[model samples]
Target: MIIRSATSDDVDAIWELNRQIGQYHFENVPDVFVAPSHLDREFLLAAIMDEHRLFSVAVDEERIVGFISARMDINENIPFVIKRPLCRIGSVVVDEDHRAKGVGKKLMEHCSSWANSNEAYQIRLEVMSFNSKAKSFYESLGFKPQSEIWAK
Candidate 1:
């Protein structure tokens, strides 16, 4: 599988990936977060530009099977208390039909290497706490829970 930088041509595919993943979250936890119509969002736009680091299309035989997007952290978020330049995994998605075939793992492995070498000390991401499958998936990949917030 080839992991390469994303370009304008890959936007639609990336958008589709985000849509599928977003909808999956909405269906799983419809009461808290409603999925948005994901067209023309700034976040998506940034992914296609040089402003953020983007890796797309784990391709084989000229077809994209999966993608990953990541960038440097830029907010006062989370309890990691990291005051240095850190990298964040923005989003990573593999086509449902292509999952469990080591595609996602490759994308992540590449992204993690890229981030660590580029001055990102800690790789952090926020997942919906209710998504046990995602939480478990992350944990199996070595992501431990640092903190938790309960909402009433």
Candidate 2:
């Protein structure tokens, strides 16, 4: 599989993957994520143009099998607080058929490289508590549990 930066041509594939993951999340946690409102192509396109964002895809046999989108957060407004830049992975998904084949890892490695090149202090991503596999994957990648957000 080949990993590369996302372009407008990959929008359809990215959208489909995003839709599938969104549905999965909604099913896993209906209260946290409503099912109907899914990601749109326009948002993907905008992400491509945003200077602080990084969107990439993994392709095999000329088809997009996975994708990851991340953004840099520069918190400069808080006085007395060091404004260190951070890279946050907003979303990442791999087609079910392509899972466990290293697609997700490749995508994440690319994101980490991008973050490192941009001088980000740290890379952060959020995974739902229900997604044990994903949590395991992140931990294996050297991401330690930082904090938890609980809900009623």
Candidate 3:
């Protein structure tokens, strides 16, 4: 498998992955907990242009197998209190068929390396409480919960 930074040509595939991840969340949660509306291609493309963002995809034989989206959160409120930049894992989605094959780890490692090199103090992400598997994966990767948000 090959990993590379996302480009304009990769937008559709990324969008499709976003949709799938949304559906996965919707199915995992109940109807009352609707998934947030996704960003359109134009907005995502603009984000891709940001110097602090690092979106990447893993491909094999010209087929996109997985993707990750992340960026330095310079305005996420945490820095206001902590006085440091935070690198946030905005989104990560590996094709269901591609799970357990280490694509996700490679993507995460890339994100962590980029964050550290860019002066980020810490990396963080949110995993829905229902996503026990993902929470475990994050824990295995040394991400401990810093806080939790409950939607009423």
Best by TM-score, which number? 2
lDDT of 2 by residue, 1-152 (tens): 99998888788888888888888889999878877354466787788667668989999999999999999888888898669989999998999899999999999999999999999999999889999989999998999889899987
lDDT of 1 at 33: 54
Against the reference, the lDDT scores of all candidates come to: 0.76, 0.88, 0.82
In the range 1-152, model 1's lDDT, one tens digit per residue, is: 78887777777777777778888888887877578575535567676686557566687666677888777875477667656777777777888788878888888888888887887778877788777766877887998987787877
Prediction RMSDs, each to the true structure: 2.9, 1.6, 2.7
Tens digit per residue, CA lDDT, model 3, 55-84: 888997898888888877666455547767
Pairs of residues clashing in candidate 3: none
Please provide TM-scores, in order, for all candidate models, with all chains considered together.
0.82, 0.92, 0.85
Rank candidates, lDDT, best first: 2, 3, 1
Q: Decide which is better by TM-score, 2 or 3.
A: 2
For residue 42, give model 3's deviation from the true position in Å. Answer: 3.9
Q: For model 3, what is the alpha-carbon lDDT of residue 49?
A: 70
Clashes of each: 0, 0, 0
